[model samples]
Target chain A: MKNNIISSIRLTIVMLILFSGAYTLIVWASSQLTTSHGNGDVIYFKGKKFYSNLGQKFTNDRYFNSRPSAVEYNAASSAGSNKGPSNPAYLASVQARIDTFIAHNPKIKKSEIPSDLVTASGSGLDPHISVTSALIQINRISKVRGISENALTTLISKQTEKPMAGLFGPERIHVLKLNIELDKMQ
Target chain B: MNTEIIGVILSFLVVVILAKPMGRYMGKIFSDEKTNLDFLFDPLDKLIYKLGNIDFKKEMNWKQHIVVMLTINLVWFVLAMLVLTNMGNLALNPDGNPSMSLDLALNTAISFIANTNLQHYSGETGISYLGQLVLMLFQFISAGCGIAMAVIVVNAMKEKVAHTLGNFYYLFVRSCTRILLPFSILVAILLVLNGSPMTFEGKDTITTLQDESVQVSRGPAAAFIAIKHLGTNGGGFFGANSSHPLENPNYFTNTLEIITQMLIPLAFIFAIGYMLKRKNLAWMIFGVMTVGFLLLALPTIWNEMNGNPLIEKMGINQHGNMEGKEVRFGAAASAYWSIATTVISTGSVNAMHDSFMPLSGLFQMLGMMVNAFYGGCGVGFLNFYIYIILTVFISGLMVGRTPEFLGKKIEAKEMQIAMGVTLLHPLLILTGTAFASYAYTQNPIELSAWLNNPSFHGFSEMLYEFTSSSANNGSGFEGLGDNTPFWNIASGIVMLLARFIPIIGPVAIAGSLASKKYIPESAGTLKTDTITFGLMIFIVIVIVAALSFFPALSLGPIAEYLSM
Candidate 1:
C-alpha cells in the first residue's frame, strides 16, 4: 500500500506536467491560427468595436430589444439568474418585465409578450430574440423611427437567422446586428 | 424528415457504428495486448512507470487498489486547492481574477476529483486561466480513475480465484495515454477550427452598436471543452457552458460535443461485452439503459416542443419555449442534450436546465437519481452492477435456486456491500435535502437566500443540488446560490462519499468473487445475459429509484407541471 501511494504521487506529477503544461501549450499554439486568435470575434461598427459573438442590450423605442440579462450584459461574468420558474422572486420579476413591456407598447396585448422578452436568458447574454418578439416591437420601432412598417418587416426578414440546415434549433433574429442594420436604414 | 429528427437519428447512428470499434479498441488497450496506436504510446507508458518507480508486473488486491486511487486523488485535491486558492498570484491570470475562498476551493477540488465537476461558482470571472487548467487536469485524471476502476472490475470478473486484480497505476496511465489523450487532442483541434478560443488572454473590451462598452472574456476554452465533454467532465469554460456561442460555435460543433460526451459512456457498455466475452449481457445492459434514456428524453422533448401552456394562453404565438435555450439548438436539441448530459453524468449544458419546463426538470432529476443509465466512464456500469446483484438475489430466490453471477456464488458479504452502496445515494441526497429544507423552514430569511425560486420549485432546487452531487452528475437546476459555505461544504462531502463508496463497493465485490472458487456452469445456473434477466434488472433499477425519489419528484417538477 505504501509503494502504491508513492507511485501514485510520482504518477500525478508526470500527468500534471503532461496535461497542464505540455498539452495546454500545444492547444494554445493551434488557437493562434483561428480568426479571433483566441481573443474573440470583434466587429467594427460606426468607429466602435463590438463583439459580434456576444449579446448586446437595446432598450430604446426605435430599436428591437435584446433578451433580458441577469448579469446586465457583462461578458466577463456571463451567467443565468439561475431562477427556477416556481420561485416567487423570479415570477415577480417576470411579471414586472411583462407589465413594463405592456405599458410601453399599448398595441400589443398583455398576452402577446413572449417569455423571451421577460425572462433572463441562460447565458444572460443571449443576442437573439424570437421572430414574434421582433415583430411585436415593430409597431413601436416603425412609429418612433418614422420608418414604414413594410420596410422594417423586410429588414427583419433579411436579418432572420434560420435554424441550421433548416431544422435543428429555432428561427430567430440577432438583435444587435438587426439594430445595427436598423440604424443604417434611412 | 425534419432536420431536428435527422440530427437525432444521425447522432445515434454514429454512436452505434462507432461503439463496437471503440469498445474493441479500449479492450485491446487495457488487456495488455498489442494494438495499432500502442507503438505511439508504449514507450511513453514505460517511461511513466519507470519515473513512478512502479513495478508494472505487480498486481494489487482490491484494498490496495482503492488505497492508491484515493491517495492519488488526495494529492490532486491538495494540488487543486493550492492552485485555486492562490490563483491571483499565478501566471495566466489575464483577467486578474482573485483567489477563491477556502470553502469554495475545497468544494471545487472535491467536485472535480469525484468526476462531478459541479461549479458552485461561475467559470469566467470566478476562476483564472491557471485555475481552469488545474480543473481541466482533474477532469482527465478523475475520468481516467473511473475507467481504471472499471478495468479492475473487468479483471476481477475475468480471473477466477485470483489473489490480485491488476496494477492500478498501469491501468490509470494507460487509460489517459491510450484512450483519453488521443481522442481529446482530436476533438480539441476540431473545436479550435470551429472557433472555440484556445489562448491565454485577458477579457477584451467591446463597444456595442448602442456605443456602450462591454468586456468579453476569452481563454484556452477549446482544449478544456474538448476533454470536458470527452472525459465526461462538464465544467464549462464560461458560466453559460456549451450554450455560449463561443464555446459551442455552430450546429456541427454542438453535434460533435453531444456525440463525444455520449460516446465513451456508451462505448463502455459495449466494452464490457467484448472484454467479458458476454455480448448478450452487454446488449441486455445497453437495451435497458437506452429504454430508460428514451423514456426520460421523449417526454422532455414533448414538453419543451409543446411550449409553456400558460405562455400559449397569453394569446402569444408560442415559438415552442425558446426562453433560456439557444436558437441554434432549439427545443428538441436542448431537451435531447439535457437527457444525454444527465444520464451519462456529463453535465455540460446547451440550455439552462432551470429554465426547462417542470416535467422536463423531473426527467433530468430522474436521470441522475437512477445514476446507471450509461453513467460516467466505468462508474455507470459499477452502479448498474449493484442493481444486477439485487436482481439476481431476488430472482434467484423466486426461482428456488442459489444465486450466482459469472460463475461465482453470491454470498452475504457481497450482498451487504452491494445493498449499502445502492442505498447510500438516496440517503445522502435525501438527508441533505431534508436538512436544507429544515434549515430553510426554521430560518427562512437566512437559508432562503440560497434559493432562487420560492415555494415548490425552490424545494426542488435544493433537492436537485443534492441529487446532482450524490449521483456524481454535476448538472444542477442552477437557480440555487450554492457557492455559500453551507452548500459548498455540504455538497462537497456528499460528492466525495457518493463517488468513492460506489466505486469501492463494486471493486470489493468483484475482488471477493475473484478470490472464491469458480463453479462450472450448470443447467441450474441462472443466465444474466438473457432478455428476462435484463428486464428484471431494469425493473429493479426503476423500482429502487422510483420508491426512493418519487415523493421528492412529486413535490418538485410534478407539482410545478400540474400547477402550470
Candidate 2:
C-alpha cells in the first residue's frame, strides 16, 4: 500500500513534467506556425487592436445590439449564466431584457422579439445573432442613426452569414461587424 | 449522401482502420512485452521504478489493486482540492481568478479525479492556469487509472487461476508513458498548428470593430484540449468548450478532435481482443457496440438535420438545428460529435447540448445511460464485461445449464457484485434525479434556481446532470444552474460513487474468477466468443437500460419531443 502511494506520486510528478512543461512547450512551438502565433487573432481597427474571434459589446442606440452577455462581455471570463428556464431568477432576467427591448423598440411587437435578443448565449461571448435578432433591431437603429430602413435592411442582408454549405447552421449576422459597418456608413 | 454523411463515414472508417494496430500496441505495452516504443520508454520506466522504490515484479491481488487505486485517487483528490481552493494565490493566474468555493472545489476535484470532468464552473475565468494544469494532471492520471483497471481485468480474464493480478503501479505508469503521452503530444501539436492558443500570458484587452474594448482570455489551451479528448476527459479550456473558435479552430481540427476522443475507447475494445488472443470475440463485441452506437447516432444526426419543428412552424426556412452549434462543423458534424462524445464518454462538445432538439437530447442521454457502447478508455470494456456476465447468467438459466465464463463458475458472490455494479448505475442516476425532483417540488423557491429550462426540458436538464455524473460521462445540458452548493456537493458524491464502485465491482469479480480452478472446454460448455453470445449481451444491455431509464426518458426528452 505504501509502495503504491509512493509510486503513484512519483508517476504523477514525472507525467506532470512531461504533460505540463514539455508537452506545453511543444504545443507552444507549434502554435507559432498559426496565424495567431499562440496569441489570439487580432484585427487592427482605428489604431486599436481587437480579437476578431471574440464577441464584443455594442450598447449604443445607433448600433445593432450584440447578444446578451452573462459576463458583461468580459472575454477574460467567458461563460454562460447556466441558469435553467424554470429558475425564476433567470426567467425574470429574460423578462426584464424583453421589457427593456420593447421599451427601446416600440415599433416591433412584443412577440416579434427574437429569443436570441433577450436570452444569453452559451458562451456569453457569442458574436453572432440570428437574422431575426438583427432585423428586429433595424427599425430602432434606422430611427436612431437617421438612416433609411431600406439601406439598413440591405446592410443586414450583406452582413448575414449563410449556413455553411447552404444547409448547416442558422443564418446569422456578426453583431460587432454589423455595427462597425453601420459606423462606416457615416 | 451529402459531404456531412461522408465525413461521418470517413471518421468511423479511420477509427476502424487504426483500432487493430493501436489495440495491439496497447496490449503489448500492458503485457510488458517488447514493443517498438520500448527503446524510448524502457530506461524511463526503469528509472521511475528505481526512484519510487517500486518493484515491477511484485504483483497484487484484486483487493490490493483496488485499494491502491482508491488511495491514489484520494491523494489526487486532496491535492486537487488544496490547489483549487488556493488558486488565487497560485501563479499563472494572469486573470487573477479567485479561488473556488469549497463545494465547487470539491466537486471539480472529484469530477476530474473520477475521469468524469463535469465542470460546475467555467474554465477560463473560474480556474487559474496552474489550476488548469492540475486538472490536466488529473485527466492523465484518472484516465491512466481507468486504463490500468481495465488492463488488470484483462490480465485476470486471461489467466484461469491466479493469485495476483499484474502490478498496478507498473500498468498505470505504462498507460500514461506509452499510450496517453505519445498520442496527446501528437494531437496537441496538431491542435496548436490548427490555431488553438498555447501561452502563459494573461488575457489580452482588445478593441472590437465596434470600438468597444473587451479582455479576451488566452492560455495554454492546446495542451489541455488535446488530452481532454484523447484521454476522454471532456472538461473544456473555455466555457464554450470546442464550440469556441479558439478551442476547435476549423473543420480539420473538429474532425481531429472527434477522432481523437473516439480513438482510445475504440482501441481499448480491440486491445481486449488482442490481449486475450480472441479476435473473433473482440470483433463480436466491437460489432455489438458499433450497432448500438449507430442506432443512437443515426437518429440524432437525422433529427438535428431536420431542425426544430417549433422553429419550422414559424416560417423560418430552417437549415437544421444550428441554435447551439458552430458553423464550421455544421449540423451533421456537430450531431456526429455530440453522439460520439456521449457514446464514448468523451463529453467534449463542438455544439451546445442545451440547444439540441429534444429527441437528439434523448439519444445523447441514452448513449451515457447505455454507456457500454464503446465507453471511456478501459472503463468502457469493464462496463460491457458486466453486461456480458449478466447475459451469460440469464442464458444459462434459460438453457437449464450451469453458468460459467472462461471456465469459472458464475456463482452467487460474483452475481451479487456484478448485479450490484450493473444496477448501481441507474440507481444513482434515478435516485439523484428523484431527490432533486422532490426538493424542487417541496421547496420551489429555493430549488427552482437549479433549473434553466422550465417544465419538461428543465426536468431533462436535472436528469441529464445526474446521468452524466453517475455514468462518469461529464457532458451537461448547460442550461442548468449547477454552480450552487446543492448541485456541487450532490453531483460530486454521485461522480465519486459511480466511478469507483463500478470499477471495484468489476475488478473484484475478475479477481474472484481468476482464482477459480480452470474447467476444460466440453460439448456442453457455453461458447462466449461467438456471435450468438454477443447478440445475447446486446439484448441484455438494451433491456436493462430500457427497463431502468425508459420512464425517466419519457418524461424528459420524449415528452419535450412530443410537444415540439
Best DockQ among the predictions, by candidate number = 1
In the order shown, the candidates' Cα RMSDs to the true structure are: 2.0, 4.1
After superposing all C-alphas onto the true structure, candidate 2 shows an RMSD in angstroms of 4.1
Query: What does the TM-score come to for chain B in model 2?
Result: 0.99
Weakest lDDT window of 10 consecutive positions for candidate 1 chain B: B310-319
Candidate 1 global CA lDDT score: 0.85
Residue B1 lDDT in model 2?
A: 50
How do the predictions measure up, each by TM-score? 0.96, 0.88
Model 2, B1-564: lDDT tens digits are 576777777777888889888988987887668997789999887877777677778889999898888877877888899999999997889988999999999999999998999999987779999999889988888999999999999888874689899988899889988898888989988877766788889887666665667667899998899999999989999988888777886667877888899998888888888888888888988999999999999999998788755544443345566556654466788899999999888898887787787888899999999998999988998999899889889999999878988788899999999999988999999999999998898988877777777788888999999999988989999878899998999999999999999899999999999999888778888898898998899899889999999999999988877765
The list of candidate 1 runs beyond 4 A from truth reads A95-99, A102-114
lDDT of 2 by residue, A49-167 (tens): 76666667777787788767777778766656655323446556666777788789998876676556665655666767778878988899888889999999999999887754454
Model 1 has a clash total of 3
Over 4 Å off, model 2: A32-35, A55-74, A80-186
- lDDT score, candidate 1, position B470: 94
